[model samples]
Target: MSSRLKRGIRRLCSTLSIPLLGCAPAERWEIPHFEPWVPEEFHPASIVPETKTVIVIGMPVSLPAVETSPSIWYHEEYRTVNTLLDINAYRIAAFLNAKGYPSVALPRDGYGHISVLIERPVAFFSHRHAAFLAGLGTFGVNNVLLTPRFGPRVRFTSVFTAAEIPPDPVLEDPLCIRCMRCARICPVHALPGNDYPDGLTDKRACASRSEELLRHYVSPCGFCIKVCPVGDDRKLYDRETMEIYDERKKEFNRLHRAWRHVRNYGGGERAPGMINKTPPG
Candidate 1:
């Protein structure tokens, strides 16, 4: 390893509190305190010909605004979180490259189409799955990553490089409580009320609801997430704490109506529908 790279790893180990490493000239580029997961086909070699590992990062959605005002802040807040992650992903990739290891950061949620046809809305990769493999979180009933610290309230992106970094262990324990709260609470009945992978079976219904909301520019319904009773942030948005903006449908609509229709972030061009609707008086 170059002296410059060794110095960087030493600092990283110190900051991350990893054990004494490379004391007597160990293999170079083993990142400190980091064992990020490289899924079956995502090994660095597969992704970038010689990438030795993947570095995953997660940013969590805070309480209140994002969770309470799904109609108002849903997409807007999502944009904010993604923008932040995108910048960091790029920065990390650049950092790796500067250290002589070629690396590439994947685009945040808004970009990178797994399906070029637009009709099929899937990401080029599964950020949730990546985070889980990196030991950052696990899947929930809503098929969202339920993190130990953030529940399903996080957004993640990753970078791949040839740094020879070890991989983080996969979480053996499940995170979902099997409460089925997410399904029982979905306004659109999009969830099948089952556990991970199979729970979000009604993709068409979910997409249709989003398309409808796009006409008025209102944030698409994310009621399932808003009502999820997990994480410390949950209390910050749930009914018991927020008298006005909690996820209860009646009050939520009352609030949404007051805002009339919000703006869209993803789906293209408004198609028309709620033409004469007015904000609550």
Candidate 2:
């Protein structure tokens, strides 16, 4: 944002005592830090060699777009963010290297050590873990991370480096409302009743259901994310009916029916027939 626009925003915010919308940044400058975000005893040369700090970057999910058709728009948001993250990660690594510190941007999602990952039903590395350590947010019952401003409606990536940066304090207060809405709404009975960080969900069952949903082009099945009555969207959406889609029933149906074409190639790869359809409200 331009200086004038930023000043204008700050002035408007000053009138209302809003905490300045922590959900997304306002294109401001940030200070660098180097605290023990990662415990050295747990670190190994193989996982993140010469890493002194981990920088966790979180991007918020678009609100109404995600709420409109999370299965579809959230997938689109994920793909876009992942691509942007990849590009930025490389740039950050190079910048760190130039400053005489080796830095690596970890892949956000992938099957690392296929056998082990499959056997364990978990990724080798997790952005959620890094985010937790960085004080970015807390975890949800479904193993998804929730930020104070966005709840679980966010995606994160991390960069490990030899550079020492001060670490932010992990959030001490619990963010989960323990409403159990996420569990009751799961169509596949994958998520057992649980809360953030302390309880575990059936990962295998969750993955299986997500895979099944993939055929219908709703791989995300963001029931947990959508249902969480937190963040700004909660005021805009009704947890009872508009959790999965918008209040407009016909538009929601159109979006759901068109997913087979919009997500024809995993995600964000719209097929030719999908061009005529309007985006869900």
Candidate 3:
């Protein structure tokens, strides 16, 4: 809140066209500090040399909050985010293909399948670290990815290819602190102990509780996302606080335009909605 810091934030906001209200000092939050994990002299076969390009697209998945049931939000947000991912995946695929890289799309079929399907586990890898490395956003204390645009309110999917694409650089900033707000809010006690030195979390515990919640037919609990100081703000200007907004907006627009184009183009692949249906193989 000092004049110098205020000026620095103002400069950032102005350069990015982000509004200043509801904005907090970057230092106020303990942003995730990720160590780079790239291996030297990586074998090309690990990534399947046939892929010409790889593009990882991050999408938002909603969880139920106290204000709005996580289940309802999850269903709604899942569809919206899934659509956004599909559209963006197509756009990136098209762009890369046009550039002469025979690209293919990857779906959310678990990490193993993702590695095999994309043939570039390193490029298409999943995890909080990979997400951070991709510049989608930083991590919260709960280890959930939080973007300035959506807070911890989003889920992501990636695209992998054989194309020699440049990976997106990680965003550098300390946005998350060791504050246990998110961990404290978890209804399932899935978070790690506050004093754990590694700052690592137990995913199995969290996922198990999430699954249990899903089985009960209640709204999915997004206590982690909800309690995170980052995503709690609902202000428009606050949407610009994170780096993912630009990509999210571009993906949204691309999908909207592409949907219209598909509707008009006619007689190509099945209409958007109909194309994804499973047929008995």
Off by over 4 Å in 1: 1-45, 110-118, 235-281
Cα RMSD of predicted structure 1: 7.9
- What TM-score does model 2 achieve against the real structure? 0.67
Candidates sorted by TM-score, best first: 1, 2, 3
Q: Across residues 1-281, which tens digit of lDDT does each residue of candidate 1 receive? A: 25555466546545543322221111112333222432334333444566555567777666544443334466677667778778877876787788778878888663333233136655555566566656777777787877766577777877766675655566678877777767876656778888766555476666666666654455455656655556665554443332333444534444334332342223322433332231111
- Residues 84-184, candidate 3, lDDT per residue (tens digit)? 66565565556556755566555533444222422432334443443555566776667667777667766655444445434445567756665676776
Clash pairs of candidate 2? Answer: 33-165, 33-166, 34-165, 34-166, 35-166, 35-167
Off by over 4 Å in 2: 1-46, 69-71, 112-120, 233-281
The reply for model 3, stretches above 4 Å from the true place, is 1-47, 50-54, 61-67, 109-124, 165-167, 193-197, 231-233, 237-281
- Lowest summed lDDT window (length 10), candidate 1: 19-28
In angstroms, give how far residue 73 of model 1 lies from its true place: 2.2
* lDDT (Cα, tens digit) per residue for candidate 2, span 180-220: 77788766677777664446777776666555445445455
lDDT of 2 at 113: 39
RMSD (Å) of each candidate, 1 decimal: 7.9, 9.3, 15.1
